[model samples]
Target chain A: MAGTWIFVEQRDGNIRKVTYEMLSEAKKFGDEVAAVVFGKGVEALAPEFAKYGADKVYVVEDDVFANYNTGAYVAQMVAMINEFKPNAVLFAHTFNGRDFGSRLAQKLQLGLATDAIAVELSAGKGLFTRAIYAGKALAKVEVAGEPVLGTIRPGVCEVGDVSGAGAVVKPAVAATAADVYQTVKSFVPTVSARPELTEADVVVSGGRGCKGPDGIKLVEQLADLLGAAVGGSRASIDSGWLGHELQVGQTGKVVNPNLYVAAGISGAIQHLAGMSSSKFIAAINTDTEAPIFNVSDFGVVADLFKVIPTLVSELKK
Target chain B: MKVLVCVKQTFDTEAKIELKDGKIADAGINLIINPYDEVAVEGAIQLKEKGVAKEIVVVAAGSDKAMDAIRTALAMGADRGVLVQQDTAADEFARAVALADAIKAENPDIVLAGHVAADDGSSQVPTRVAEILGFPHINVITSIEVAGGKATCSSEADGGTQVTEVSLPAVISSQVSWNEPRYPSMKGIMAAKKKPVATVAAAAADNKVKIVEFSMPPAKAAGIKIEDEPEVCATKLAEWMKNTVKVELK
Candidate 1:
């Protein structure tokens, strides 16, 4: 009687890409997958979840849930889990997920696994794999709780290939006013040309070798041509030449893209810990001695200025 | 106004870390205040210097050896330091619980901490601390302005920036943009010896998460040279993309 649950994260009543990825993976285990979404007028987004392989969509329309409230979201999730009695739950390893997951795990007295890159059905249950040590290693996490909870890194799992197969929208039986302790006054979205870092398939990151903020233009141009997300090393971010969201290092965003292009980055161990998991790495650096070259699938020792422009032009052709 | 900043001691990011029997090796590795936490400390001091806050308190969780780090912060202008002795690995949830308990005791107008520890790369602690305290929280915050029991913070999000206002007593994770943290002066280091530090034993942590074991990554094969000339390098890259890696060009 244990079913799989996916928290359908939404903003302005629209489904995010991560929601689809979670449901898509959940269906592989042949578990009865359900998505929990909270917001007024969000029932419209339920079918979208279905298209991505959810069995049922749990819609909780409440004004209090309009914006993200740290206290209320955690309380609602904790209560919903107790009511649903799920065997496993998957969440998008996002800011909100990071904020709420651990607390829910604690209240339920269940172990929480975070930022997992992949989850698979093993034996009768599921096993989650996550990148650890700043992306230097992979760790397979086994949860001790009867019901396992994991936050999946976005973009790691593919979108649903089987379309229009999921079930109809249903009201979440567990959502209650008692668990709502906080209210959201407003909700703001990040304004970027590309998708979320973890959700992006291709990431182009720059390092101190970019010279200054203006140097990001070259990286951005290439990313734009490839329709990829842009990232930076900790040094570039710390130097105020790039935004923190674009940093890919030990303390920065952990990304596992199909392709990662690092330009001008020397590839410090900390920096490598973030993007080393990337399936394909292409490094562009003037210094052939840069450590980043050691792990790169392809190394271009020439100036990124000369190499990137040429690559971009060739790709455009 | 009063602000509390949580500081931590971490191996310098530049240092090579070795795992010894599932734990970090205690080699001759030099320990420094986590750079992000140093930003938090600097932010707290800047607030105090601006006369926006009457006092700033710095808290840390570690062994007795961490007293030196606390003293370093005190010399940088933190009014007092609190040390929580715990043997637990500096994981996110555990540190959040301990920091939350300590912050509650102080009852500061705002609580500050780094978004993540550099070593673990788990950016869950600050937001977790915010949840445990039941406060509105913001991450990657660069600037903070307080007035009338409300603080407006500018957060660097996915693409652009977000300007948000939360009431006092909120939690914020400091970003590198907070300010250029000042270097500890010789005078400050000397004055730190006179500052007081209170160490308390933390309650037994209910460690829910467990690491099965730690292992290093497989050694990368030696990199192949992309030939000598620029055009040849480009050709070689193209050939590798088409033949070996089989990456299709758009």
Candidate 2:
């Protein structure tokens, strides 16, 4: 019987937190779960994956694997799947994962489900559930064949700790010419000190009601005080108050943080779809009738200009 | 220069979505163009203004009923529109494949789509189309530039933004923040009638995926307790985090 495989995505030399979450989620479905790590800093991540319930870790460490090249990564994934069959493959629902997961599924003639919110084993196979139509609808999908691939949304699966012994298995397949199809001369990452919006456990977002960019800066201050990432509605981004990087909407980023604090956002349906899955939501708006309050777990009926400073000061303490 | 942008129609976000008999109820909901495609259209139009692309063609694969969305794109400054008419119940992958075939036949210089349909948000359509067309593809592109037969796309990734350069005849899935799509002006709305929109039979697609059932998400628990004072509210929230959710903040 094939075991579950989790693709551990890393950048530079740090193991992303989502890898651990995927391992934690994988352990629930299969008796033996393994990890496939492609990049330079993977050796250090093996122990972390094991601490998160990985039975074995597949390490493909090479200079070529250091930077993300879609053609090469998808080729490597196909080769790995062909060699060591797995019942399912899980990936973080990131840009790289979204690029590779769908291509890998299409190449392998398999089904892929993206942004999975929940996963389980049913009737001797793996099953995944995800939201669709923005957050309007939920769909459950069952992957019937071997190597069922799924890319899970960040913050959806709880990161669990399973401190135990883990074995680091050297890459079973070596990188070949075909594995390095695309070449990258250099990579320049974004220069932002804030945590990524999708990965952040807490998010503070502003909307059209913020009045302008200065108000968004206030929202950013509150986010920083609370150790949260900054996010914005489509309107805020369109108004040039926030950079595109800070946008959270159906077509923007899907963030399911522990705490989602919305200020001056009326909670358009499109905006709510991206953040409704958050564990706890708090909306502060001057308009008591704003739609954001409908889905918010907690709401404050006061002008954000007044309430935000008080909240920020209190949280800073 | 020729550009192709894929568009889809989805329910407005605030529409009360209801599932009836294991399928999405077809309420008389107000339909708007998928927000992502609006970004794509905006990008295409911007390219036109830069003199890099002259003609923009918007295409969609759906039932005959989808002609309305095609008209909507025509109103948005597309030089022309094409509808790959198909029956209802078409899966996303199949629609993308068919649309890809149609686009390939047209041989546009750049093909762009909204990153994903808001209704489904599967985000697989463009990648599938790219694979089928054997062209370089990028997702979540916030910025773009075409020079010397190559396109440079800047996309938002998990921790940071990423940049990639691909040759022309590539596929790009646009994000909502890519550009502010222009609203139809009175002049453009009036000129929309002059644009030519063609309809053709959809190419055959082997759809392997199926939607068994769809349901609204589970309701959130009862109202959250908030203290009148901000300090008291924070304390209560902290208590709930520790006791109810078991998440202890440092």
Candidate 3:
């Protein structure tokens, strides 16, 4: 019988939404779904996994996993995989997931497909589809090795109905301090109530046309009114108008939100690669020739400084 | 400190990709060192200049043409180059194994690589190599400082920055913000010719994954355009977003 394992990612004791997203996707592979969580005080989050379709939750609670270290996490995951021998392992394509999952796949010599947008069972094996050339093309990949590993791109799959058995178990393997060679000195979190850009339901992004940081403020206000996450194009980030973490483009974060709004941004191909998969796109730019209008569901030719305030006010009413 | 930088040759970022018969058509296309990898090479050069690194070696796993990319790194001031001869079809796992094998022989103090290859965007090979070598790995590092045999760096995370310190012999993937890569000058180009580039046979390994097919994304339909006063445009956009896009507006 085939078994599927999903890495349940958590931070500061709260579970991330992508874990459930992966669980929902894992259920479709016709395998016994398991969720593996590694962290201190994460056992309480097991019931939440059950709601998302986990047949069993494997909790590796230890102080050694309190902080996210690639070496320690990979060691623990490798140990768990060796014991369980799951046919497939799923992870969210987040920073930590990419770090540890890729390493685990390498240490075990397993077939790994990263940033997969779609996963399905074909011919009794898993087929993963990923984007290449900045979302211009899709490549379907099939894993030939046992225990195939994949990292699912966040916001691509939907959360399925809750109908799991809610069973939870503790894994025997434990991570030791010696397993870690790196130490996290500090975490400086961005103080924002807005949802993370990658997982946001809506994203509002500005480009060079924002003119300066002040103009980006206007974009932020519009995003706030719409309850959306704020992002910037490569031009804006390169100009220091925004932080690199907020950049959305080929070299930046890929977002597949339900709605995306672009203001004063001429959609470069690189920028389009990151947000083209969004369910709905709205573009606002003064230049009618801007390529962003080509993919937008709705387009407006206007000055963003004037348009943003108007949108914010209109939404207020 | 001995530092090894892994680089890849990829199409220029601005190159318009064309596919023919389910593969990228490369004729007449310009190839450059993967931009992020260039940043890594630059970082190593900076470290060497700062007297923190004693030597820098660049490595790549690709066909013979990858030497051009290595030469570019050597021009940027890497000491030597190693090319692991392999077919372009090798998957990330196989590439990592080959690279680990090459890297293990050097026994360097550190390994540097691009956060992700511009072509495939896998972001896997370096991390996999670190795992195979049992070394600590960090990705998307913005700044790195080596002192007292430990490297402390700030890396980008989901909602913020993470300040981390890893022991020597760690693998770090360079972010674009790490450092600006220097351009190869005429003098540097001449010197690069004298740099040694050793080609090594790559050990064959089983590929875990196979690309079944490749196809272009569907064309997007033309959108509705609105040209009106700012107020009118805002009202219309809000209406479309609510009625058509059906987004929940707070």
Candidate 4:
């Protein structure tokens, strides 16, 4: 049955949690939620989608599908969309999803919206609420067209366990060189024991108050202690203490973690735009009048170097 | 090799966003070249400096003000520019179509733009242009090197960096850290005024989506602050994080 479709995101055959979250979200709309997963040897995870309320699982497997290639994934998705004619398609706003969604929308000339914090479906059309001007404001966009396409921001929607029809359908299609415009040579990952910043439930971030890498290391130690991700303001990033990927701001990644801990961050407007939507914000700063304190649910006027270590030591108790 | 750089003028990241009558009030707002697009312009200029590219053409498609974006690119060291005059507001698809229409005539070996615009933040026009032109597209790339009719690029991926080899005549979008943009020299500023910028009318397409409403995010709930010794504050903060925030600690 043609209905809402969720693009399953996976890395090395392990399905990302966002896919389940999207499926759970699609189920709430009272539509037939089918998950389309791509990659080689990912059939075993098909049933897992069912547990999260996927009515059908369309698996496209090929050696070339293991790593994400924009054109290849776009072509496969276009073929599937044409065949199934789903009214709506949802994807996680991860790197692959954002890249693939744009190209797919162009190839098909479909109305597509990206980075939606909230979404609703009416008469097969998608109404998406997305942050504009880098979270300074929110806009409600009416993506009204056939096969409405959109990408959901991470951590906004809750994961649900509603069961659905768990039929697996392997599409008899393969991606060749012509479908791929670029060849992936290698993937080098940053060495980090913490969670991915955007998808993390808890984020511990450093700012200018973080004097140097040593201070950031303390932040990282706390992140590791609590299984949270580490983030930094543009100041710390520009200071060369952290990578750009860890930056959270208007130019950087916007995070909506459940709990965001800021150490030495002054919470400038640009910086606040990124993490203001967080469920609960806490700040540790030497300045009691820091703007970060204004947005924080709890604040402490103390030096992070002393407070963070003490907090770590005490939490260990 | 020839490079074509696309740029757009948008509000600075710090500009206040004020919506009036279902639109953003443009009164006294400072618009500059999108920070990311400046990176793309810098990348193209670097390619030109290396003698690998003979010509760098900057292109922009928007209102007349978009010419400022092209002029800024020109002052930064591009050889020429193309301004596709699109006075009416359109979706990313239409803008891409117009841009691709302009790009097709140039047929450069490479096209570059920002990973995403600061205004709409759609991140579509360049990729869509690539699709329309039947070229490979890579976005938010940190570095690129060209040789033997191919581009080797390192792009930002979730949790990792993906290195890819794209064929020539590809589309590349730049991340902020790609390169530092240079200030236009006085000589460059005078030279940009003399730079040739061709103007063309935009192609038409139906608008795709309508913004129903714009609203500010809800205000943050009030919070508590504690000023005390590190030991006491740490104890209270940890307790607040675990009990009040209800997040896991250790």
Question: Per-candidate TM vs. native?
Answer: 0.89, 0.91, 0.97, 0.97
What tens digits encode model 4's per-residue C-alpha lDDT throughout B21-102?
A: 8787788998899999999999999998898889999999888898888888999899999999885467787888898999
lDDT of 3 by residue, B92-207 (tens): 98898899999999999999999898888888988988888888877899999999989999988878889899888899998877888999988899999999999998878868
Stretches > 4 Å off in candidate 3: A122-124
Interface RMSD of 4: 1.3
Q: Write the per-residue lDDT of candidate 4 for residues A189-299, one digit (tens) a residue.
A: 778878899989999999999999899989988998888999999999999999899999988989999999999999988899889999999899999888899899989
Q: What CAPRI-style quality would you assign to candidate 3? A: medium
Model 3, position A298, has a per-residue lDDT of 94
Off by over 4 Å in 2: A122-125, A163-165, A172-187, A312-317, B224-250
Query: Candidate 1, which segments miss by more than 4 Å at Cα?
Result: A106-110, A120-128, A138-141, A160-165, A172-191, A212-215, A234-241, B90-93, B242-250
Whose TM-score is higher: candidate 1's or candidate 2's?
2
- Please rank every candidate by TM-score, starting with the best: 4, 3, 2, 1
**Root-mean-square deviation of every model:** 3.2, 2.9, 1.6, 1.5
Residue-level error in angstroms, candidate 3, position B152: 1.3
lDDT of candidate 1 over A87-184, digit per residue (tens) = 88777877667656765765555567788777865333556776765666566656656567788887778786854345654545444555554333
Backbone clashes in candidate 2 total: 1
What class would a CAPRI assessor give candidate 1's docking? Answer: acceptable
lDDT of 2 by residue, A186-276 (tens): 3566676778888898888999878997788889887777678899998898788887777887767778898888988999877988898
- The residue-by-residue lDDT of candidate 3 on A1-317, one tens digit each, is 46788988888877889998988888886778899888888888888899999999988888899878877788888777778778888888888888877988777778888989999753336788988866767899987555778888888999998557758878775579988888899889899989999989999999999999899999888888778999999999989998888989887888989999999899998899889889899999999999999999899999888888877776666
Cα lDDT of model 2 by residue, B1-250, tens digit: 8999998877776676888888888779888888888889889989999999999999988876666777777777888999888765666557766888799889998999988777877888888788778787878888998999888887766666677788778898897768778888888888888888888888887665555567788777655534365545544544543455444233
What is the C-alpha lDDT profile of model 1 across B1-250, one tens digit per residue?
A: 9999888888777677677777667689888888788999999898998899898888988887777679889989888999988774645557777777887888988888876666665567666666667677777778888888888887665434667777778888877667888988999888888887787767555765666656666676766756456656655665564465554442
